[model samples]
Target: MNRTLHRVGAMCAAHPWRTLTAWIIALVAAVVLGGAVGGTPRDDYDVPGTASQAGTELLRERFPGLSGTEARVVVHNPAGGQLDPALLDRVVDALRAVDQVGVAGPAQPSADGDTAIIDVRYTVPVTDLGADAMDQVRAATGAARDAGLQVEYAGQVPEGEPTEGGLGELVGVLVALVILIIAFGSVLAAGLPIVAALVGLGIGSSGILLLAAVTQVSTTSPSAAAMVGLGVGIDYALLLVTRHVEGLRAGLAPQAAAARATATAGRSVLVAGATVLLSLLGLILSGLAAYRTYGFATAIVVATAVAAAVTLVPALCAVCGRRIVRRGRLDVTEPQRPPLTARWAARVGRRPAVWAVLALAVLLLLGAPALTMRTWPQDAGSQPTENTVRRAYDLIAAEFGPGAYAPLVVAVDLAKVPQDSVPALQDRIAAVPGVATVSEPLLSPDATAAVLTVQLEFSPQDERSGELVDQLRAETLPAGAEITGVTAVFVDIADLLAERLWLVVGVVVGLSLLLLTVVFRSILVPVKAALVNLLSVAAAYGVLTMVFQWGWGGQLLGVDHPVPVSTWVPLLLFAVLFGLSMDYEVFLLSRIREEWLATGDPFQSVVRGLAATARTITAAALIMVVVFAGFMTNADIVTKMIGVGLATAVALDATIVRMVLVPASMMLFGRANWWLPGWLDRLLPHLGRRGSAELDDPADAAPATEETASLEPAASR
Candidate 1:
C-alpha cells in the first residue's frame, strides 16, 4: 500500500499541473452534475412501524386534504369584542391570493367569540416549498393584523434557512490558518491543508446534493458533511505536508520528499479515513433512513478528503517544495534535538500509573452526567423567542394551552368495534390520566376508522408529555386505539432508538475493535483502544448534557434555554464520536507500535512513540476542536449541540486518551501490548505493506540520537 501510494504521489509530483487540473475538472463536474440531478433534501421525522406513522399513512390515504401541510391563522379581536364579519372575509381573501395555498376550512370561532382559526392547505408539500413561497404566506397573513386583529400564523412556514446554517467552515479555516502558521511558520505551507479541505468539501457537498435525487438527504446533512470533512480534511493534509517538510530536511529531492511524505503519512490518512467511514457506516444498523443518509453523506466527504490528501496535496507540495524552505535549499546541518513532547512523554513514563489513574478519574467525573441523560425531539416551544415558530407556540399556549400546539391523535379501528360502543370509549379516553381535553371524534367515510385529537397539559418535548404518552399507550382501551401525533411520533422515535441504542453501540464497538485488531495485529491493543475511546466519548456526552440539558453556560453556545438532547443525537454522536476518537487513538498507537516493533522494548517504545507523535496529535486535535466549535454559531440548536459535543470529545480524547491513559496503559501492559493469540494471528488476514512507517529507532529505523534526531534522514535511503 505504501509503495502504491508512493507511486501515485510520484506520478502526481512529476505532473503537478495534470493532477491539479484533474481535481479542478472533478470539482466542476460535481457542481454541475449535482445541480442537475439533485432535488431538495427531505427532513421527514416519521418513524416507520410506529403508531404515529401508521396513523399518518391512514390519514394520507383517507383524508388527502386534511393530511397535507396546513397554515393555521389564529386572529383575535383586540377590542375584546365580537370579530367583524368583514375582517374575517378580508383575511380569507388575502390567503386565497397566495399561489401555493388554498383555504382548507372556513373560520372556526372559539367559545370566547374573540378568537378564530382559518386553515389554508398548501398545494405543494411544505418541505418542497422555498423561502419565497413562505414569504408570500407570511405577507398575506401579516395584512390581517392591520385590521386591528392580533394575527398569528402557525404550521409550515419556510424553514429554508440555508441548510448550511453555521459558517463554521470559514471560522475553522481561519483557526487552522493560525494553528498551521504557528506550527510550520510558513504561510504557504499553512494554507495547503485549508485549500485541500475546501476543495474536497465543495465537491463532497455537491455530491450529497446529488444524492438528494435518490434518497431523502436532510438539509442539515451537507452542513454536517462539511463540518466533519473540514476538520479531518485539514488534519489529513497537514499530516502529509508535515511529513514532506521532514523529508526536505532529510536531504531528499523535491519530488522524492513529496513522494516519501505521501507514502508514509498518506497511508495513515487512508487508514484513519477508512476507520471513520466504517464507523459512520455503522449508522445503517440503526434502520433509520435519516441516519443512513447522514452516515453515507459524511463518509463520502471523508473519502474525498483522504483522496485529496494523498493525491492533490502531494502535487501541491511538489509544485512548491523549494519555496517551502524559509532558509535557502532546505538542509538539516545541525544535529537534531528531542522536542518538548518527547521530554514530557519520558517524564510521564516514570509514573504512568499515577497519570493514568488521574486521567481516568477526570473522565469518570465528566461522564457521570451521561447516566442521567434524556432524549426528546425539539418542537416549536424549543425555538428561540425571536423565531416565528416560538411566537406561534406562545400565542397558542396563551389562548388555548401548550398542549393545543401538539395534540395527540388517537386513531381507533372502528372495524374491530361496534358503532354504539364509540361514545363509551370516547368517555373512557377523555378520562385517561394525562388527557386535558378530547375533541369530538371524526369518523372516516366508511366509519371503519376514527381520529380523536387529545390535548395534554404539557408541551411535546416535556418529560411529563412523554409520561402521558406511555400512560395512554399502556391503557387497555377499547376500539384498538393507537396514539399518534407530533408528540406521539417523537415519543415513538425516542422509544425506537432507546430499544436499539445498545445494539448500535455493540455494532460500532465490534467493528472498531475488529478494524483496530486488523490494523495493529494485536488483541489487547485494540481492546485498550476501544475502552479509552468509550471513556472519551462518554466524557464528551456528559459535558454536553451539563451544558445543553442542565443549562450550564448553554447561553454561550447560542441556546437561550435548556433542552433535552435531541432524540437522534445520542445515536448519531456515538457513531461519529466513536470513529473520530479512534483517529487519535490510531494516530498515537500506530506510531508507538512501530517504535515497539523497532526497539523490541515496550518501555522505551512508549516513551519514544509519545514523544514523536504528541505534537502532531495535539495540533490535529486542536484543528478539529476549532472547526467543530465554530458550529456553535448556527441558529439551529441541534446543530449547535452536535458541534459542541464533537468539539468537547476531540479535546478530551487528545489530552486524556492520547497524552495520559494511552501511555500509562501501555506502560502497565509491558510487552503484552503486542500479544496476538497464535490461532487468531493465523485467522487474521495479513494486510501487509501499507502498515505504519513512523520510526526513528536505530534498531528498526535511522538512529535518532538526540544530536541527529532533528536531522534524521528518511529511513532506508
Candidate 2:
C-alpha cells in the first residue's frame, strides 16, 4: 500500500465517532443554508446574442405585446357557434381580471364569424413563467371553467411541469433504498446510502438556489440536478460500503476494514466524480443560456456527491464500524489459490483480442437506429396527448380560421423604407403561401416599427408552422430588414440549437473519451468505451422513436398517440444518459482493470470482474430504471420521453453491454487488454493500487491487532 493510503487508513481506525459527527454537522449546515436560497426555472430556448438569438430578439422587439414568443391562451365555446352573450361577457370579465396579464380582450370573430377569441397576455416578463406562474394559470383555468364557459390554456409554462406530481423524485429515492436493502440485507446498511444521498441532494439543491440568487439558473435545472445528485451519491456510497464489507470478510478488524475501504474506494469515487463534473461542464459549449445553467448546476451537484462520498460516507462508516461488521455474520475468509476473483482473473489472461471484437460488433448493431432520429418543434399543448387544452385549440382552428394559436408577427421598420415600398412589402407578405389572413399593419406607438399579424392555415406546432417561418425569412422579408413573432422566434431558436448540436455532441464525447483514456491508460480502451456508450444511447433513442414518435404504448405510458418528440428532450437526455452510462462503465471497468492488473490475464479478469461486481451493478441499475420508469406515469410528453429514454438505456446498458458484450469481448481479448505502449504508459499517471491483497506470508497478512488505527481526514484534490 502507498504511504498516504496507509496513513489515512490508520487514522480511520482510531476515532471513528469524531469523524462521523463532524460530517453530520457539516451536512446539516449545508442543508439549512440551502433552504434559504431559491433558484429559477430555465427557459428551453436559446435567446439571442448570436445570429439566431438576434433573430429571436428582433422578433420579440417587433411584436411588443404579441404573445411574447410562447404559446398564449385563446378561450372560447363552439357549442353555440358564437359564445353566449352572457358567457362572452363573463369570459371577458374573467380574462381582464387575470393578474399579470399584459393584454386581454374578447375580440371580434374573423370575417367568416361564429367564433370569439380572447387574447389574454401576461403582465410579468414572459421569461419569468415558471412553477409559480403555472400554478397561477391552473387556478385561473379552473375559475374560467366555473364561469360556465370552456377554458383552454396552453404554453411552455404548463408543458414543462412534471405531470406525475412528485412521484418521480419519490420513486428515485425509494428505488434506491430498495436496492440497497437487497444488496446489504440490513436496514442500517441500506439506510446509510439513502441518508448520504439525501444530504448530498439537499446541499446540491441549496447550492443551486444560492447560485441562482447571484446569477440566473433555470427552474428545470433543479429537478434534473437533484436526480443526478441522488443517483451518483447513492452509487458512490454503495461502492464504498461494498468494499468495506469485502475487507471485513477478509478477516480485518472492523476499524481496519473501514479505513482500507475509505482509502481505496474513496479515491475511485473522487476520480469518477471529477469525470462526471467535467462531462456536465461540456454543456457550456451549447452557447445557450438555458443549457449553460443546466451544465453549471449539474456540475455543482456532482461535486457535492463526490465530497459526501469521500468525507461524509467514510466518517459514518468509521463511527459505526464494529456495529456494522457484527450486525451480520458475512463470510470474509480468504480462499486457497488467492481468491475466486484471482482464479477468474487467470482465465482472462489466456485470451483478450477475440473478446474485444465481439463486444464492438454488438454495440454497433444496437446503435444503428440513431441515424434516423428526428426532432419535433415547440408548439402549445403539443404534449403527445389530446387534453382539454389541445381539444380547445383544435376547436378554435376548426371554427375560427387556422393559426388560432398565435399569428406570425412580421416587424417592418417603416422609417427605413420608402413610403411607396411600405404598401408593397405588406402586399408581398400577405401573398406568401400559407398566409391565410393578414391584419393591417399596426404602427408601434413610436411609429418607427409596423407590426403585421399574419395568421397561417396550420397550427403553430405543425411542421408547416416552421415552413411558414422559413418562407418569411427567405421570401417575404426584403433585404436589410427583420421579421419576428412566436413562430419566427421558435424557428430561429431551433436553428440556433441545430447549429450547435454537433458541438455539444463533440464536447461530451471528447471529454468522456479523454477521461476514460486517462483512467485506463490505453488508446483502444477509451475508443471502445466511447463506442459502447454511444451504442447504448442509440438504442435508447430507437426505443424513444418507436414509443414516442410512433405512439406505440402511448396509452399505457400516459401520453397521447403520435406526438412529436420535444426538440430539447433528446439533447438533454443525451447529455444526461451519457454521463450516467459512463459512470456504470467506469465502475465495472475499474474492477476488471484491478483484477487484470493482478493476474495479467484478460479472460480470467472478465469473469472475476463480472462475478464480483455484476450483482451490485445490476442492483444499482434496477434502482435507476425504477426511478426513470416512475416518470413514465407523468402526463407530460417531455417527462414521459425522459423517463422512457433513461429507463431503457439503464436496462440495456446493465444487461446487454455490461453483462453480455463486455464479458464476451474481454474473454476474446487476452493479455493485449492491458498492453499500453511505453511512452503512453509513462505519460498516464497511475491513481493507486487496488485494495484487496492476498497473504504471501500468512502470519504477516493475518488480521490486524485490536488496537485500531484511525483514518486521516480527506484532503480536497
RMSD values, in order shown: 4.0, 5.3
TM-score versus the correct structure, for each prediction: 0.91, 0.86
Top-scoring candidate (TM-score): 1
Error of 2 at 369 (Å): 3.1
Query: Tens digit of lDDT per residue, candidate 1, span 1-717?
Result: 667777888899889999999999999999999888766675666678887787777765555555655567777777888777677877788888887664445777766778777767765555656546656766776756777777766664433334346566577779879998888778888888889988999899888988877777765777777789888899899888888887777655668778887877787788788878987998887767888898989998999999999999989998896576565334355437667777777777889889989999999999999998888876667666666666677777777877887788877777676667777777887887777898887887767777788889887778999888887778745536777767888888888888877888898889878888887889999999889888988998898789978999988766778989887778888888888888878778877877877778898888887876787788889999999988877766677778888999999998988888898888888989999988998998865543345322222232444433544443522
Instruction: Indicate the residue-level lDDT of 585 in model 1.
Output: 80
Instruction: Quote model 2's TM-score.
Output: 0.86
